[model samples]
Target: MLIVSGWIAVDPEAREGYLAGCRRVVEEARATPGCLDFVLSADPLEADRITVYERWASDAELAGFRGSGPEPEQTAEIRDAQVHKYRISAIEPP
Candidate 1:
């Protein structure tokens, strides 16, 4: 399993607009095969923060869905990000 998780920072006032623009991405990702979960959410205490989390069955599925990542215009909106990918070796009850 592959897990992609991180947070991003944008202009406080522009945060909502940035997330609103991701509705399609969220919907499409959830519908894709091998996608276990995908989400982009606002940080309750941080107006400039957006939390990102995604789980995929494999690298191929993630790559197939992610293609080239955010569009240029959207990429330009982000001021910073701290995201990372993890390869899970085992799973157990949480």
Candidate 2:
């Protein structure tokens, strides 16, 4: 499985707009093949901070959905972001 996690700092004035866009993005991504999950949340400590977490069955599916660029609105509203991808080697349920 492939996992993706990230945090984005959005323009304070554009926070609501960015969150609206996030809803569309998450819905679309969740409908795509091999998408396990796509979640977006606002940070409690920072009003303009957004958190992202996603899971996919394979790299190909993730690439197909993400493409090579960020959405236009994303680039416009996001001031900064940090994203990381990882391959899950194991899972344990408590």
Candidate 3:
């Protein structure tokens, strides 16, 4: 499994539009095959900072979705963004 987490720093004035685009992208992403999870969240202390989290069944699945590129509206409003990926070796459910 693969995990992806990131934060996007958007223009303070453009935060709402960016979040709307993020929601649209997340909805589409969650419908794709092999998409385990996809979500976006706001940072409580930072009005312009948003956090993203994603889980995929495999690298191939992730690449397939990511190949489409970033959402235009979201990208336009973003001042900076960083995404980190991880490969899961094991999972334990409580």
Candidate 4:
């Protein structure tokens, strides 16, 4: 399993608009094969932040769905981000 988690910074005023624009991508990701879950949400404490999380069944699946990443126009709006991919070796009751 794999998990991608992080947060992104954007203009406070443009934050809602940015998240709105991501609706389609988020929808598509949730529909894709091997995608366990995908989410992009506005942070409660940070007006300019968006929290991101995604889960995939395997590396191949994640790579296939990540084709080309976010659009350039969308990427341009991100002022800063800290995202990371984690490879999970096992899972147990949490």
Q: Model 1: which ten-residue window has the lowest total lDDT? A: 65-74
- Please give each candidate's TM-score: 0.97, 0.90, 0.88, 0.96
Question: lDDT for every model?
Answer: 0.96, 0.88, 0.86, 0.96
lDDT (10s digit) by residue, model 4, range 1-94 = 9999999999999999999999999999999999999999999999999999999999999989899999998999999999999988998999
List where candidate 3 sits over 4 angstroms from the true fold.
Answer: none
Q: Looking at candidate 4, what is the lDDT of residue 53?
A: 98
- TM-score of candidate 2 against the unseen true structure: 0.90
**Candidate 1 structure quality by residue, lDDT tens digits, 1-88:** 9999999999999999999999999999999999999999999999999999999999999999999999887899999999999999
Q: Worst lDDT window (10 residues) for model 4?
A: 58-67
Clash statistics: count for each candidate: 0, 0, 0, 0
1-94: candidate 2 lDDT, tens digit per residue: 9999999898766787778877878899999999999998888889888888999999999999998667785787778899899999888997
Candidate 4 — which pairs collide?
Answer: none
lDDT accuracy of residue 41 in candidate 2: 86
Model 1 stretches with alpha carbons more than 4 Å out? none
Model 4 residue 27 lDDT? 96
Ranking by TM-score: 1, 4, 2, 3
